[model samples]
Structures are given as C-alpha cells and as structure tokens.
Target: MADPQPARRPGGRTARVRGAVHRAVTELLAEKAPDEVTIAAVAERSGVHQATLYRRWGTMTGLVEDVVAEVLNRGSPIPDTGSLRGDLSAFAVNAAAGLASPMGTVYLRAIALGVGPAEGAPDGGHPGFDARAQQLQEMLDRATARGEPVPTLPDLLEVVLAPMYFRALLLKQPPDEEQAHAVVDRLLALTRG
Candidate 1:
C-alpha cells in the first residue's frame, strides 16, 4: 500500500491528493488497459486508502475521464500563428505527434471503445460516440474569424487527420514532417474544393 498521507504541496491538500492519484493512474495505464485497471491498484500504488480513490473519482471511468480531460486540456492548446495555414500546419504536426504517443493513443482507443460502434464512426452518426468534433469545429470557427472559410469539420479531419492517424496506428509508422505537410496540403486543397 502507498503512504496513508498525501503530498504536502503549496497548492494545498486537494492538489496534493489529485497529484498523487493522477500519478498512480498514469503509472497503472503504463502497464495495463484502462478497463483492466482498478481503483484498488491506484490506491495501492498511491499509498492512499481505497476509500480515498472511491471518494475522489467514484469509479474507474470517472478517474479515466479526469486523466483524459487533463490530457486533452494540455494537448489542444490554441495554435495561433496569425495565418490559418500556419496554425493548421502546427495543429497537424502536433496532432500527428500526439497520435503516435503512447498515452495519447491509449486515451483515443479507450474513447473509441466507449462509443457505440466502429461502423458508425465514419458517418459521424454513432449514438454515443464522442470524437471531440466540437474542438475541431472551434478551430474552424477560429480560422473563419481569421478570414478563412472552412466548410464541414469532417472534411478537414478526414483530409488532414485521417492520414495521420492511419499511418500512426495502422501503418505503425512514425509521424514525420513529410506526413504532416502532406496532410496540410491536402486539407488546404479541400478548403478550395
């Protein structure tokens, strides 16, 4: 079991507990799937009581959501490079890199599993699928504000993102500058098409 007490940080007690729990869950994810991971594992890893894990996150999904939310929050920092092309290229590069990362892929796959079905994904008609499409739309809105006219969000995602994820996950290839440029150019063409 981990220490009964949590870290004593300047951010105060809640911060300390949250940090410990986050670390514990992160380490657990390194070794196991999110579905297989348990609250007891986190509690033992953190040296905190099982009650603490239950009280804090309530359930495995809750804890996983917290971790995912944190990951997304940090991952999608606004990319403002004055020009929409520059901003999108930067976003593509970052997205490519993230899809190739261990933590990022896991969260993505987990989220996919939570959705209704795979077949419904391509059409964006899944009952409970959450592709974070809103974030992409927000990016479009920001671009529009910058004088760029972007049509549907899926077109952007399919042309710019599909290839990145396809290569990163399916092809088992690393995300490189060449791939990022390819996606960006394709997306740029789509904007005109």
Candidate 2:
C-alpha cells in the first residue's frame, strides 16, 4: 500500500509544509531526472529538514508517489455534472487539459516508469494505479446513482479511458475538445441505456 495522504489542515503549518515540499519536488523534477532528485536536494529547496522528509515519506519512491498524487489531485475532483454524459464529458476535457501540460506529462511518465515496491506494497504493485482505479470507480458510481447504466470497470477502462491515455501517454498528444466530446459520446452510446 502507498502511504496515505497527509492529514489536511487548510492554511495551517502542516499544509504550508506540504505545499513547500510539493513545490520543491516540482522544481527539482523540472531541473533534473526523476532518479536524480534526492531528499537532501528537496529539503534544501523546500527549507524543510531532511529528517522530516525521511520521517514523512519513508523512501524516494514514496516521495515520488506523493508528488504525483499531489499534482494530480489539485484543481478538481472527478466531475459530478448532474447528467452522466455531462460529467464524463467534463472529466475527459479536464483530463485532456491536464495531460497537455508539461508538468502533467512529466508526472505521468514518472509514475508509469518509476513507481514500484514501497513500504506497504510487498507484492510490488504501484499505488498510483490503484488510486486511478478508485477514481474511475467513483465516477462510475456517480453515473449509476444518476440512473445511468455504467459499464464494468474493465470495460470502462478498455472502452472509455484507453483511447484517452493512449493518445496522451503513448502518442504524447492531448485530445482537443472535439476529440474529447467524441470519446464521451462514444462511451455514453455504448454504456447508457
């Protein structure tokens, strides 16, 4: 298992520390390879002690996972736009916008390439994968609650997200609004009753 996210205390000392740490991680990643970003460097940039980083993050991979999580979690929660089509469309468009960013591309590549075994994951699965799956499930649950018939998780991944991720991660191209709308329309046509 990955370490749980830090307890959020808005505008408090803890939040400030996490924000500083996240900023340091972003700056260092922009400057160097993921493999070269060390706790000492992060501490130096963040003004948070190395000991605090070690105590909180446990390992380099743990720190990386947190950094990915923080970046991905910012700005939005999954869309809940009343109608399933509307929600999925909003989600796809927002996601495409995110993947289009340089930092977003770097973060995705790092998580896909560098994430591996950590303290809680003895079986060696990436927690980021698990986190993404959970997010997808939440979206499906929202759709179901809205009385839309949702596809199973595997089908959702295959039919809905696969094209989006393939274009964003593999082709290194973000979908335009028309492309995003097409994806949402196709998925809704397939799954909606």
Candidate 3:
C-alpha cells in the first residue's frame, strides 16, 4: 500500500505550536461559536495545554481563525473522471459518503452553522472553501478535455451535489452505488432535455 500523502513535519517549534493550536481549536469549534470557546476546553479536547493555547492563539478570534483554516483544510481532494457526469457522480458519492457517519454529520452541521446561503466559498470569498471545491471543480474541467465545455460550477453543484448532500444531511441517508450513479443519470437527463 502507498501513502496518498506523505507525512511531513515542519522544522520549527513555532510551526508545531501553530499546528497544535489549529487542530485543537478546530476540534473545539466543531460544535460551538468562537466566543464559547475556552482554552481549557480546547486543551481538554485536543490534548494540548492551556498554556500552549493561550501563548499561541493569544485571543479567541485568533484561535477561531486558525481553527477555521484547519476545518477548511481537512477535506480530501475530489477524484477526476474525465467527464462532467462521471466526475460529478464520483464527487457526489465521495462527498455524500462522509456525510453518512455520525462524526461526518456533526461536522457537516457545524460547518453549516458558519455558512449562510451565499455564492463562492463558505468563508464568503471567492477562494471558495479551500481546495475541496477546486478538486470538485476539476471534475467539470475534465469535460473540456473531452471537447465539451464544462458547465458553470454552481449549475454543476445544483445538479450533482445538491441532491446527494440534501439526502445525506437532512434525511440521514447514506448514498449507495445506485444513488451515487443516479447523480450522473439525472445530470444526463437534464442536459438532454
């Protein structure tokens, strides 16, 4: 078996402290607002010391931002399938698969708290929720490689992601192979109409 990502350590103690704070605080914010966040709580959840949380984060806002980075960075990259339909099916399955677990549902709900109905990213900027969106968007890029123009990314989201997530998050349904493949089927039907 090969490691999908090679583990690399930062050379500095400062970087280590930063990483610890980021992980700890993000875990804390998984269910609560930054104001409700406490150093003791972060320490208890992350196994880091209260001193470290205080020294590194300096303030609640700092802690919150660092944790936000960690949360946004936690997602794995989406797969590429060389066609909008195939790639979206893969993306839908991948995204929905995670939403099936309790931890996954909790994380999804936590993120939803921070995200309002908006365009672009969860952060309200165009950078768009770290690389997960880009990885997902790559599925559309695959269409161009096959001589078809990739549709608008949001439109792609509506057709592929909307249903998958809605079912998984709101209905507590796990996406099966049939349901995953239906994303592709639905998109194809819509496009042909």
Per-candidate TM vs. native?
0.72, 0.75, 0.64
Q: Which of the two, 1 or 3, has more TM-score?
A: 1
- True lDDT of residue 169, candidate 1: 61
Candidate 3 Cα outliers beyond 4 Å, as residue runs = 1-11, 22-39, 47-74, 116-130
| Global lDDT of each candidate | 0.69, 0.73, 0.60
Clashing residue pairs found in predicted model 3: none
User: In candidate 2, which residue pairs get closer than 3 Å at backbone N, Cα or C atoms, i.e. clash?
Assistant: 1-120, 1-121
lDDT of 2 by residue, 1-193 (tens): 2334456657877778878988888888877876778888899999999998888887666777777765655537777777777777887787777767778766776576554443445664444556667777888898788787887778766766678778877887875677778877887788765
Sliding window of 10 residues with minimal summed lDDT for model 3:
1-10
**Cα TM-score of candidate 3:** 0.64
Q: How many steric clashes does model 3 contain?
A: 0
Error of 1 at 175 (Å): 3.2
Model 3 C-alpha lDDT per residue in residues 75-128, reported as the tens digit of each score: 566666556666677666766666665445545554554454432234443222
Off by over 4 Å in 2: 1-12, 117-142, 145-147
Stretch of 10 with least lDDT, candidate 2: 113-122
